[model samples]
Target: MALDIYPAIDLKEGRAVRLFKGDMQSATIYGEALEFAKMFEDMGAKWLHIVDLDGAFAGIPQNLKCIEEILRTTHLQIQIGGGIRDEERIKLYVDMGVSRIILGSIATKNWEFVKTMARSYPVAVGIDARNGKVATQGWAKESDMYSGALAEKFVGSAVQAIICTDINRDGALSGINISFTQDIASRSGIYTIASGGFASSGELKILDENPYISGVIIGKAFYEGKINLKEAFALFEK
Candidate 1:
């Protein structure tokens, strides 16, 4: 499978931002949402991964306008996560042209809801864990459950993908946790998307060598000039 490159557009206050290790307080603002989305599309990005930081912390979506504008304007297949807890918001965004929805906080607390949605729509679950245990509520609360087995729960749920993040590596741009990422996908038997600490296109060659990894989410790495968009696309492009 081709390694899909996802340009992340994490929304903090209706603008693009990236949080260090999922810390809300450590967010680095990146500017307006629309302009960034168009830039990724122009650079040949196949997918856009958006996280609503406000929504993730507040337990409800707060960046609908920003999300909607990107959906209405871009040709990118976007996967939206954060602050998405109930069905009304899910239906609303799906109607707004979201290609897929990512279930995070609720996916851990309500497997039935995640299972239900995965069956009816294209959905992925994010297991944001630090040291193998799951973290919820924007990574502010940590759980005792192991990350790999937690993702395994979706085996027969028809889930499109399982996106796992090593919270410690997120936004550090040190590099991706390749072995850790592959373990999650292998144990779950699902298409996995690896996130956190992606540094360069050189790492893409390493990730592409592994079959379990279906995609990689690049954030600070892309914005910081550590990884160039064209070079990244060239490595992963089919």
Candidate 2:
């Protein structure tokens, strides 16, 4: 299968921010949300991945307007996660034209909602983990669930993709945790998207070689200029 490289535009309080290991207090905004999305699209990116950091942490969407602005500004495929707990919010984003909605917290606590959304929309599940175990409540808190087991829960459902992040490696600019991702993908049947610790094009190249890794989300590396989006797209684009 061909791999897709998604440049991430994570918004917090209507601005771009890359949090350290999902820590809300450690966030710092980079730029206005809409402008960033426009720039990313202008860079030849076919898909953009955004997350509502405030909404994910608060358990209530606080960046809906910003999310909407991004959706309106770009014609690229947009996949978003954070604070998408109920069916209505899921419907709202899908109705608002988001290509995919990522289910995180609700994927563990209210799996039925996850299954329902996956069945109804082009839904993706984000399994954020710290040391091999899943974390919830916006990744501020840890959970007892394992990533593989979590993926298994939706095996019979319409879950089309899974985004697995190695939390400890996030925003640290260390490198992509390939072994961890390979483990998750090898154990699951659905498409797996790797996030966190993606520091350079070399790391992405490594993931591109894996048949199970359908996409890679590069956040800090993209914004920090450590990774080039156009080059990545050239290498992975179908």
Candidate 3:
């Protein structure tokens, strides 16, 4: 299978950001959010992942206009998450040309809703976890259920992929926990996209060779200049 790279553009108050270990207060702003989209597209990114951090906590999407701008200006295939709770919000984003909508809080709170969504629309589930337990509400709350068990629930359904992220490694500029990601992909028998703590071009090549890993959502690495965007595209795209 081919490995896709989703250059992440996490928005907070209309600016792009990267938070340390999923902490809401630990955001490090990095200029305009739209610029990131343009830069990623210029560097040959095939897909983009956007998160509405403010909306994730406020129980509603806060960066709709900013997200809309990115969509309007760029031809990048986009998948968005964070505070996506209701069907109306889903319709709003889909109608605006989003390729896929991710189910996060709803994946844990209302599993039946996720299953129903998988049946109808192109969908993915954000399986953000810390030390084996799934984290919800933008990683502010922890759940008793493990991430793998949650992935198993979507088996044989329309759920397209599991965006598995390890909160402990998130934005730490450290390498990703490949074993944790591997476990989820193997156990669930689903296309697993690894997120959090991804750094360097070496890791990109490694992810590409792994048959189970379908993609990786990289943020801090790209913004920090640890992974050259052009080099990443050449390696993963090849």
Candidate 4:
């Protein structure tokens, strides 16, 4: 399968930023959210992965204006997560033209809600794992449920995809956790997108060879210049 590349624009305080190990204090502001979305579109990105940092922490959508601007101005298909705990919020995003809605903390707490949403709208389960366990509340809290076990619950569901992130490597540029991602894909029996710590073409090559991984989220690597998006796209396109 062709690997889809989703250039990530994590929004903190209505600005594009990258957080270290999911830490809010470690946010390194890049620039305006619209500018980043435009840049990714110009670079041939088909999809954009957005996370509302403030929303995730506040349990409410805080960056609606910024998010709406990006959606209106850019043609990039957006799959957004953060602060989406209820159906009303999901409807709000969907009405705004968001292609996919990602349920993170809520997915860990309510599998039935996720399944119900997936049946009606495009939904992706955001499984942020720390130390092989599921992390929630914007990674501020860890749950006893194993990541794979959580993923397994979605098996045979209507979920559009599973976005699995390794909290330890996210924004740290340590590297993509291949085995961990593959395990989620296998357990979920759904298309899985590997997120966090994507830093090189070598890692992309590795993911390209993995049949289970259907996509990846590129964040810090793109912002820090660890990997060239154009070159990575070329490699994948070839």
TM-score of 1: 0.97
Evaluated with TM-score, which candidate comes out highest?
4
Please, what is the whole-model Cα lDDT of each candidate in the order they appear?
A: 0.88, 0.84, 0.89, 0.92
Q: Please say which candidate is ahead in lDDT: 3 or 4.
A: 4
Candidate 4 local distance difference test against the native: 0.92
Query: Where is model 2 more than 4 Å wrong at Cα?
Result: none
RMSDs, each prediction? 1.1, 1.4, 1.2, 1.1
Instruction: For candidate 3, report its TM-score.
Output: 0.97
Which candidate gets the maximum lDDT versus the true structure?
Answer: 4
Task: Report the lDDT tens digits of candidate 4 across residue range 1-238.
Answer: 3889999999987789999999999899999989999999888888999999999999988999998999889898999999999999999999999999999999999999899999999999999999999999999999999999999999999999999999999999988899999999999999999998998766887898899899999999989988889877766763
Each model's TM-score, in the order given?
Answer: 0.97, 0.95, 0.97, 0.98
Candidate 1 lDDT tens digits, 81-139: 99888888888888888988899888888878898988888889998989988899989
Q: Against the true structure, candidate 3 has what lDDT?
A: 0.89
